[model samples]
Target: MTSTQETTRPRDIGGSPGHWRRMRMWATAHAVDDFYQGLVPAAVPYFVLERHFGYVEASGLALAATLGGALPQVPIGLLADRHRLRWMSPLGISLAGIGAGLSGLVPAYPLVFALLLTAGVGIAMFHPPAGRDARRAAGGSATAMSYFAAGGSVGFFVGPALATPALDTLGIGATALFIPPAVLMGLVLLRHHDRTPGATAEKVRRHGTDQPGRFAALTSVEIVRSTISTGVNTFISLYWIRHLGAGSGLGGTALTLELGGGVLGTLLGGRLADRIGMVRTVQLGNAAMLPALWLMLACDDKYAALPLALLVGLISNIPFAVLIKLGQDYLPSRPGTAAGVTLGLAMSAGGLFMPLLGVVAGHYGPRGALTVLATVPVIAILLSTALREPVHEPEPPRATPSTTHDRHR
Candidate 1:
């Protein structure tokens, strides 16, 4: 291949060269930061069982963390884009971990709420800038972004596992045990933040315009996907245990299978996006999810439901990384804004919809809720089909020799 052709070729499916080193550093910190996000839910059962908090109070605590973590994301994204806040990721990760860790020591309910809120803020702060940087290093390859996402997925699973054991043995205060990884990671990320190539080059463009229509369309699709995902996460265990008469171990196993499918989906989605167009892969994923969800819901046996849930999870998450990349692509000028809306805000918003599903479950049972959730992907599919990929304005064609010669003649 000619040197020029090689230079202009898109990055490999693996990633741009040297991306792994930075991907590892950023992704590792992401895992640590996201661990706190995941830990919040695990701690909820502890509050209910040990603190003697009622369901409403427990949910309020969760609400505090959710609001704090998810709400500030857009403003944070704006800040990262506007100010090039290089230290935000390190600071955010540290505070997120520290807040969650210290929550155990705070005896009062109000104090615990405050601590969780602080941790949520930290988690929120880390994501926008971290994702923006990861994109820069990704060099247009969605596969690289998948690695970043997979790190968080691993951390999410690890958080619950780690929390369950420690909180079981040491009580809720055992949350403090999780602090070291965050602090160490924060320091490491902070010290090396600027070492990567062209750290400032990806800054938000002052005069660059965004495709607002495309961005809006993309966000709508994400909301549907996120709502379905939240529903599955919230009720899949219950469906297994109560509905299918599965034992607690099997219920947990079902949840694990689903989440594990998501991790695998995140990695493979990026590869699929690289091979097929991002839009097509995303559509295919949502299309596959419709049947998977139905199959999971239809399965009468516990074992049958288990693999189906895994399939549902895999199909549901197949667009995860691609959607993030597409959001940024659609709003290239406001990448942080795109990332925050798509990755952070939309997800939290989906949690808000979970109540509606609960209401359905209350009236018609979990099967009814699953039925509604299955239909959510159809909205995603429609949106994906209607939306057009963002098209960069082409540069005026360079003058050809014939044209130049004609002009001279």
Candidate 2:
């Protein structure tokens, strides 16, 4: 078929009846995949408590998962771009669940680390193909992509919430209970792919030139945003307790509020991006973060700062889904790679900077650590200045029948 014909083929349109159904499927799959990632941190304390692991050993398990998830995504994405990998999503999630679930069943520290690492790889394998397909299913709608992003956020929250109680009641082995969701979700996704004709053969044919430079700039902005998020989430509670003189319960409440605000912000960002354009939406989010964070830090009363904490989370995360969508737009030919770097690598890279922030916190307190974090948005704003809206090249003109006949002759 001609390029024009291919371009105009019937496909899922954004906001259509079937669009939401497909989006929900992808989002739910994403949640299942990321849940195992969330389980690692939730299960870490149990490892220490039950296994009598040292702090360093417990940290190693987290590191194992982090390394496994982060390091392989780009390569996996490249593979996804080159071939149809419909099975990756379901298989990846199942591996994630199996690795995490089995970790608690074993007694050896190395076994736990290996299992977590295996789960991390599973998470890695899931993102590229799933993200690529999800973007296609989203029909280039940023608002739709937000639903997908929000799924991962919700998964992270649910993982800890459900696992904590199970661990508390049944000891560490309760992690086995979390396995069913992954298996069940995997089966659902697998069935969906199998039943949908041509689903495995669908490809994103590129029309525009790939903008690696713009994608890189966007990645930088995301990295900065990720760093800021990590810093705030890591230190906000401590800042509340130590600096604002709030009790421990109030400090935890502050963290919860921040996280809840993030979910809202992700959804809001998608809608805003659709209305105002992704670049402007991202710039606005970064610009707004400056004042929101400064006000939160300046507040003396913990109670008053609680709302500010929510505002900070909201503003900081408003660009979250926007960046993801923009990255795919910038590199249309390699949506899988864009998703891998933006969704996985940037986040992991951002967390790697925490030791520096931790040192700052150690010497100057959580306030000092957060004070350093407050300046991070400026970097994102600067990087965003280099980004331009991706322009999709128009499809080539249709060939005349006479021309086709002549060419064949």
Return the top candidate by lDDT.
2
Clashes of each: 0, 0
Model 1 alpha-carbon drift over 4 Å, by segment: 1-11, 14-19, 197-200, 203-209, 392-409
TM-score of each predicted structure versus truth: 0.91, 0.91
Candidate 2 versus the native: TM-score?
A: 0.91
On the 0 to 100 scale, the lDDT of residue 279 in model 2 is 92
Model 1 score (lDDT) = 0.81
Any idea how many clashes model 2 has? 0
lDDT for position 102 in model 2: 94
Model 1: per-residue Cα lDDT over 246-353, one tens digit each: 898898888888988998898889889888778898899989998899888888999967888788778888998888888887777777777788778987788999
Q: List the residue pairs that clash in candidate 2.
A: none
Model 2, range 219-262, lDDT digits (tens) per residue?
89988998999889889989999999999889988987887788
After superposition on all CA atoms, what RMSD does each candidate show versus the true structure? 5.8, 3.7
